[model samples]
Target: MATTGVITVSAVVLRNAAGSSVLTVRKRGTTSFMFPGGKPEPGETAAETLIRELEEELGVNLDPAALRPLGVFRAAAANETGFEVEATVFEHPTVPIGGPAAEIDEVRWLDLGLEIIPDDIAPLTALMLPALRADPRER
Candidate 1:
């Protein structure tokens, strides 16, 4: 049976220099691509969780200071049916290059310039696309 309830996680957006695209990842057994992040350990702050998750999933160690608040968002869980995701999202000041690690199966750059987001993205990724496009840094 599918698990139900809200999953609280810390996610990050790592954009290319042009900010036209962001990095996304797919877990080992999942189809949808979402921001690279995971659930926090007990008592971990949002930033702490993101920093640890980024390094674990992508092998990119991030400074806590480099994470910019990107606002909290909620969406349907991509891999877990009957559950929703509440993500405390952050944006890394600079894009980091890394490969799949831990439970990650693949990594890809998601183009923010597309008029339509691909169906394979998680709901949180879809929700953030418009905002990312309008960001001044993309200019």
Candidate 2:
């Protein structure tokens, strides 16, 4: 059956060393940046989807056991008009290895403190900012 309306994605909110910034990526032709992840394959859990996507886009390998649940986030899809993304978010500590591969066009470590309204951004990213910046370690 074809899915409709909101698209669900699983994403990781990884922080760079010292936890000063969070990682975001712009896909192949998109300028807006968001957490790294994608839609799940049939029968796959959100964490499994994130593990697969991270490897494809960032050359990062992960043990599904390592991911910690953050929460579910929702906002308008960045590039897909008229749709929203319902993201199941996770947090992992390790920074990625080689990146900007596959559908990824750019890799950026944006400070959690940066204004949520950047020139170009995924709505999901904007929605997560306040919580990220509010984390005791981020302050």
Candidate 3:
């Protein structure tokens, strides 16, 4: 019998500061700028995963009460690894703390009008970019 695999659950945090958007750059081996998030551990909910990953990657703790679930999206693998992912996107008010954790190479606040976001991000995310640019809090 063939074994069925589980989908990886991740979150992409959308944080806006002073009318600018926040993004993180992974190491050279990874794809372009991405929101802070990662896979969910066993028995953990998506929201829990978002909170934990954000804190781990960005060094800022998000108030559980402040997380607003934007929506869920799925896309083909962005990296060479062929595993598909189901990403739960969220909009949150965040503040930068200390330096980013080891997983993150650099972090910056980008102009909402940035013209060169990577093409590997999900199509659904790209579709929402226009609206997000207009209102970062829009889910």
Candidate 4:
């Protein structure tokens, strides 16, 4: 397949209290579960994008100060064919309690403790799962 242009986005890893699990979401028509976030709007910073996305998708308002940079990653786009995703990932200081909203169809708590992640996950989630599982911690 021919490569499409990259999609820039921001995402967060919201771990459960035990850090055994992290939050993931599936958009309305998407099969692959991914971190709860979306692409940035015009002129939005990464943290701003995350805060807006969280509020829109999960009805949770996040403080920019509470987001810790996890690193940037690039992977095959989960739902968009022939495109790559460039994600600025963050680790949330605490899990925000919320349900699926907006374009989100389902909210799932993915068990990081599992030896193998399920096949129905976005490439970016799969890429980071190992590191998260190896270093589970409580906030």
Top candidate by lDDT: 4
Ranking the candidates on TM-score from highest down gives 4, 1, 2, 3
**Between the candidate structures 2 and 3, which one is better when assessed by TM-score?**
2
Write candidate 2's Cα lDDT for 32-133 as tens digits.
999889999999999999999999899998778778898998888888887888999998876546768999999988877665468776889888888878
Candidate with better lDDT, 2 vs 4: 4
Better candidate by TM-score, 1 or 2: 1
lDDT of 1 by residue, 34-137 (tens): 98889999999999998888888899988887788989999888988899999999988765578999999999998887887898999998998888888838
The residue pairs that clash in candidate 4, if any, are: none
lDDT of 4 by residue, 6-83 (tens): 999999999888888999999998899999888999999999999999998898888788899999999999999999
Which residue pairs in candidate 3 have backbone atoms (N, alpha carbon, C) closer than 3 angstroms, thus clashing? Answer: none
- Candidate 3 structure quality by residue, lDDT tens digits, 1-139: 2223335666655555554665544533665455667778899888899778777877778777888888887654444345555688777765655566757776655456778755555443455567678774432
Model 4: per-residue Cα lDDT at residue 133: 79
The local distance difference test score of model 1 is: 0.87
TM-scores of the candidates are 0.93, 0.90, 0.75, 0.96
Better candidate by lDDT, 2 or 3:
2
Query: How high a TM-score does candidate 1 get?
Result: 0.93
Question: Cα lDDT of model 2 overall?
Answer: 0.84
